[model samples]
Target: MAASLLQSSSLSLLLVVLVAAASTARAQLQYGFYNTTCPGVEDLVRTELLAKFAADVTLPAGLLRLHFHDCFGAGCDATLLLKSHNGTAQRDADPNSTVRGYEAIEAVKATVEAACPLVVSCADIMAMAARDAVNFTQGPAYQVETGRRDGNVSRKEDALRFLPPADGNVTVLTHYFAVQNLTMKDMVVLSAAHTLGVAHCPSFSARLYNYTGAGDQDPSLDADYAKNLTAVCGGPSNVASVQPLDAVSPTTFDLGYYQSVATHRALLGSDAALLNDSLTAAYVQFMTNASSVDTFFADFAVSMINMGRIGVRTGTDGEIRATCQVYVD
Candidate 1:
């Protein structure tokens, strides 16, 4: 009896140790905050600025994707904001155009200025704000690794050119992301972002009124909703068009975008390509009927981590600019 009791106690102690270790491992894996020590991260930036930036992105995931599309190719510098008039961000005045998330960056700066002063770089703040924006919307909360220095230059034209066209086909889009070392799986998984935002009419006219020209409204699109969109878009022209980036659920940060493509109703030609592309077809299928939003969320988290690590000018390669728009003195 004594021997059996001793063996049982030892087994219980072993189980407790194993449980503690597992908990620690899980915490380490979920560590999503910006760490400045990671090669190119900078913590001079404050999280308050990032929180404020999160408040400014009113649009859903589509616009967020637009922001990433532009930033990824040319670097995350907010060149898209250079066109603001009267020193206010330009997108604030235009319903037809979205400046991606520049307003969010501005908000972050405002908050940081009030409290932390000039400690944070606009570049790092912008990155954190984006992650916060996702978190605010019930999306995954990411760990931010800090220590990124600011860039001295920002050009609107560079942002425009770098961003993939809303209506681009699969090949073009795939090749564009490939330049960043991302695979087709990453493209399709990231493209699932269409699940949460509206699209301007000018972005989707090509797909809506193509050579066929019958222009049948997508059966899945709400008729009343379509009427409202047409009114704002001014009836698609050969050169101009619009469609919500995600037709299934443009307000919720979920996997509906992937589900929509499975039905052949992808709102953008670029989106539809995911289903047909040889490289992404399998991924598309997996996301199409995914039982839980967690699958997409997990993939998105991993991709964002990878994306953030791209194009980093680390060590002595980059300068810490005083202003995001001007050269570091």
Candidate 2:
């Protein structure tokens, strides 16, 4: 009884320590972190991104994906921006192969540097850019806390380990998010970002062909939708093709993804996995109503902020790189 009591006490103490650490980490960041050093930092980023978005309407989705990939790989650090030295960097990972908007970020960084050199971190720039991306795509406009420092390490292995697979089920995805201190709700909400992006054939080809390794499609995927995807993606040889994640409103950041999931027309198995869970399925059903847009937007804002806080380095922990792709020695 005494040993059991001691074990329980130890676990309780560990939980408290973890909670305190998380709180401290979040406290290190604040809205308007660059208010004094770079008063117009946010405006600069937005303006630069606007130019890129004007040129390419699809840029918002790419930037949003970049932000998500960065956060998942190493706690919202700008490690994903690093140029791989030996093809081992996080950005070189297979999962991040389609992650675009690097030029946009670099351009934004250059503009910020011209205004306030060495004041804003790339990590913070990415956080703000992601917020702007969502706003540009008609999603919710939310304030992101800044002051994140760039991490020095970037490994393909980290990306492989941290990023949940496109084919992940609820169990796999939940474990992936849980490892980052994110809840199942956060997983569902963040997955809604899919409403704005597209998936390469390679990302979801299994669902269209040989889902069970016997050349059959995924039963969870809508048959008609699978036929359409197969038409778009072609056979195994056509790995270069892509498909919209939310066919209804591919460019909008609305609840179309939830509607797709509710109908089992979601492009990715990971998306369909939401319906397999009671809580997430109910969330998806609730979100299918057009009125739930505000609720989803609000919840998504909170979840993004939460995701932005993962594994962040602050308060002299990491350096501010002049160029996001190159390390500051």
Which sections of candidate 1 miss by over 4 Å?
1-63, 66-70, 82-97, 212-234, 237-243, 290-292, 316-329
Q: What TM-score, to 2 decimals, does candidate 1 have?
A: 0.68
Name the runs in model 2 displaced over 4 angstroms: 1-27, 327-329
* Per-structure clash totals for the candidates: 23, 1
Please provide TM-scores, in order, for all candidate models, with all chains considered together.
0.68, 0.91
Give the Cα error of residue 243 in candidate 1, in Å.
4.7
Q: What TM-score does structure 2 among the candidates reach?
A: 0.91
Give the alpha-carbon lDDT of every model.
Answer: 0.56, 0.89
User: Using lDDT as the measure, which candidate wins?
Assistant: 2
lDDT of 2 at 99: 93
